[model samples]
Target: MKIAIIGGGPGGYVAAIKAAQMGAEVVLIEKEYIGGTCLNTGCIPTKVLLHSTEIYHQLRNEAEDLGLEINDLKVNWRNLLTRKELVATQLVEGVKNILRTMNVEVVRGYAKFTSTKTIEVSLTAGGKRSISFDKAIVATGSKSIIIPVPGHDLEGVITSREAMSLEEIPESICIVGGGVIGVEFANIYSNLGTQITIIEMLPELVANMDQEIVNSLEEALLTKGVKVYKSAKVLRIDRSGKELQVTAQLGDDPFQVIAEKVIMATGRKPSGDGLGLEEIGVKVDRGAIQVDRLFKTDVDNIYAIGDCTGGVQLAHVASASGLMVAELIMGERMAMDFRTIPYCVYTNPELASVGLTERDAVMKGYKIKVGKFPMYGNGKSVITGNVRGMVKIIADENTGEVLGVHIAGNSATELIASGAVAMRLEATVQELITTIYAHPTVGEAIHEAAESVFGRAIHIP
Candidate 1:
């Protein structure tokens, strides 16, 4: 079978490689660059910067706590950005090499669907070609949403893409949304000694999240001197002189906040722009390409995945969806299972979770018990002087099956894989309690949290 995969994100490229390995001739059409936004702008770039900022902050601020002394700690923005660019470039080349090694015909062009079965490719090299494929996968991802507030077209207003690739760190920044991207950048810049003010239209940061988690994060943000204002709507942006004046709803009248730079992190929507999926009868719901349970679109032999499908705009979700579509097209039966996909927010005391939250369980009418362990009670957390978070787990009170796990503190994300698997396998809290956790490690916090559900917490009541 001949297959064409459009967009070279984690979803698109993976789908291409998998289909090739399955003994099908695969062609990948990428109009811009391969590896798409996840590698170039979204996931990998931000994470790389986050890690760098983390190291800078740790060495400058926490070195004293760790018994290391340094004076005049400074951040070199030029060198740091160069390093980020180097890492991103290396990864991009690595992806191109992988595609070449996989024998997936890499077409540098825009893919336009002329019909359900035929797509016209306009080459970036100034030519046109036509390709007919038995199956096609569309993994074109999403882009950041910029609101239509006035003066948005001005000079200092930019999206997350521009924010991540900043020429130099802005002296002061006002992030226009308090969602994942906004909050993460807030934490990063705040730690790096840049003035940050986060404005959220919702009542809480990560408002769609569990209130407890948001409370903890809000506390941390407040402690870090981040000016967080929620339940506020941005009215307009007026560029005056060297500053961008943000006029937001201040109850009755308007209030003004002027900043050196402004980041728009309202949300992300499907980026099917200029791909020509509509020119061929492929249906897109509110700019997102709609897909079925098997990752198939309304058009037969066509598939859509990742942010384009609009379920969860996560890198892992896209990767899994791409792989599933590949397997499905390879004459194999595969279903996308999202029972316990882990989600993370990289913050000071990182937030991580899998499966349902306590509120989610209750709203769904599940009678559940909860277990919680504060990092202050953990030997490792106290010893390392990172005692600023907790481990929370929810489970069915009657059956003891684990319902969800949420953690904040060092390596919270890494600790969640076990929780995800346990949730998937329906492991009970009792089983968690029985599991041996090595002392003086974050892993033990998981076990201790489980012990809390039954009112037998060793470290805390």
Candidate 2:
């Protein structure tokens, strides 16, 4: 079978590789760089900066407590950015080599659907080419949303894409939208000595995260001198001299902040333009391509995944969907399940969650019992002097079934995977408690949290 996968992102590339491994002829098309926004501008690059800033923050603030003397603790922005670029390039090339090894042909071009099984590619180099396939997978991802506002096109106004590769760090920046992107960038810049003011249209930051964890993160950001303005709407961006003035409204009051740069971390929308999807009768909801559980579109031979499908705008989710689609095409019994997928945010005090949140479980009419263990009590957290968060476990009250796990602290992103596995295996709180955890480790908080669910936590009074 000849399979054409559009957009060589996590989803498209994984789909291509999986199909090729299944003895299918696969060709992947990408318009911009491989690995998509996640690698090029979004997840990887941001984390690189975050990681660097974290070390800088530790050296500057915690060095004295650690009994270390440093005369000149400074950040080389250029060198840090260079390292980020090198790492991204290496990973992109690694993905390319893997695809090559799998014998999947990769074409650099923008693919537009000419028919259900045919696509015309406007090559990045020059000219155009058309490919006919027995099956097609649309993984064309998403782009940063640019809201229509007065003076939005003014100089010094940019998106997350531009924020990643800034030539010089802005003295001050006003970031609009306090979602994951906004909060992460605020953490990054604030630690790097950039004055940060986050404006969110909602009542809270990271509205999708556990409210308790969100509160902890918000407090942490404020403690770091990052200003947060929730329930505020940005009215306009006006260039004033070398700075940008951002006018915002909160309730009936209007205020403004002048900064060296203004970033629209508002959100992202599916990038499905020029695909001729409508003409080909592929269903599109809002800006996202609609797909069933198997990632099948209205057209039987075509499927869609990734941010373009709009179920979850996460790279790992996209890759998982791609694998499921490949298995479906290969006549395997498979379906995409998102119930226990992990969500991670790599800030200083990271936030991670898996399975149903407390609110979701309550809304679904489940009688849930919750256990929360403070990180300050964890031996490792106390030893490391980084204990400003906690772990929360939600379980079925009667059955003791692990329902959800939320964490906010050091290595929380890494620790959330255990929650995914526990939920996937339908493990009970008893099982988690019985499984011995290593002493003097942050992960022991998870074990303690499960024990706390039944008021049997040994470490806690």
Candidate 3:
């Protein structure tokens, strides 16, 4: 069988590899570099900076605790970006190596369907070709949403991609969205000593996340001096000398902001625009491609995954979707279970959650009991001096089954997976509470939270 995967992102690349392993002749088409936006710009690159900012912040807080005196420490933006680029390059090369080792043919170019069974490729390095395949996967991912406000094309205004390769850090930045990407950038730049003010049209930042988690990170951002504006409409933007003049309406008065640079993290939509989805007999519901439970579009022998499908724009979600599609191609029947998928916020006090929230459980008609555990009560949290978070678990009140787990604090992002897996396996609160946790670790918070479900918390009063 001949398989063609378009857009070498997490989904496309993973699908290509899995197709190859399943003994199919695969051709992976990439528009620019391999790994698409995730490695080249989005998930991996931002995470690289997030790690650096985390370490930088840690060192600043550690000097007193570790009793090491230092002076005049400042972030070298050049060095920091250099490291991010290096990491991105390494991962890009790694993905290419995986493809080559698996004998998957990689065509570097933009892919669009000229017919139901043929795709045209326009190479970045100057070549045009066409490939005929028996099967194809569309995973073109997404691009930043650009608005038609005045001065939209100003040199200082940039998207998430341009924001990643910034040659120099700006003195002050005005981000146009207070969603996940916007807030993440706010934290990254603020920690790197860039003045950041996040403006959101919504009532709160990360309006999609659970309200409890949102409140937690909001407090953290305020403590770190990030200026947040909510429910404000941006009217226009113009370049004024060496800065950007942004005109926004906050209630009655027209609020003006002057910043050295502007970033539009206003969210992204399916970049399936111009791909000729309509011309090729593909159906698009709204801005995203329509897909069934198995990621199959209306057309047979054609599959769509990742950002193009638009259910969840997360990299891991795309990866999981890829695996599910691969399994379906192998004649396995399964649904993409997102109940155990974890979400993380990389701020100073990290926020992470898996499964339903207490409110979600209630909305779903589950009579639930909540377990709460504070980090201040844990020995490791106090010893490490990062005692500013909590773990809470919601469980079925009558059946004693764990419904969902929510966390806000350090390393909670990595810890919630345990709770998520238990939830998936239908593990009761008693099962997790009885499970052995290692001594002197933050993960023990799970046990404490579970214990508190029945008002038997040992660590906290």
Candidate number with greatest lDDT: 2
Better of 1 and 2 by lDDT: 2
Clash pairs, model 2 backbone: none
Q: What TM-score does candidate 2 reach?
A: 0.98
Any residue pairs clashing in model 3, and if so which? none
lDDT string, candidate 1, 1-461, tens digits: 99999989999998888888888999998988688887788777788778888888878878988899898888888888788778888999998998889898988888888888888999999989999999999988888888999888889898988988788788899999999899899988887888889989988888655667667777888887889878889989988689889999856766788899999999999976566777676778777887787878778889999998877888888888888889888988665568878988888778888888998999999999999999889998888777888999999988999999999888887999999989878899999999999888988999999999998889886
Evaluation by TM-score, superior candidate among 1 and 3? 1
What tens digits encode model 3's per-residue C-alpha lDDT throughout 1-461?
88888888998899888878888899998877689888999988898888898777767768778677779777888888999999999989998999999999998877888887999888878878999988788888887888778987899999888888888878899999998899888888887778888889999888766667678788877877788889998899988898999999888878988999899999888876567777888888666888887789888888899898777788888888877776677666657677788887777677888888887898999999999898888878777777887889999999989888888877887887897788888999999888999979888888999999999999887
Instruction: Give me the candidate number with maximum TM-score.
Output: 2
**lDDT: worst 10-residue window of model 1:** 207-216
> Relative to the true structure, how large is the alpha-carbon lDDT of every model?
0.86, 0.90, 0.85
Candidate 3: list runs displaced more than 4 Å: none
lDDT of 2 by residue, 1-461 (tens): 99999998899998898999989999999989889988888889999999999989988999999899999889888999999999899999999999999999989988899888789999999999999999999999998888899988988889988998899988999999999999999999999889999999999888888888877788899899998899999999998888999999999999999999999998899976668898999888777998887889889999999999877889999999899999888888565558878988888689999988899999999999999999888999988888989999999999999999999999999999999999988999999999999988999999999999988887788
RMSD (Cα, Å) of model 2: 1.0
**Model 1 error, position 235 (Å):** 0.3
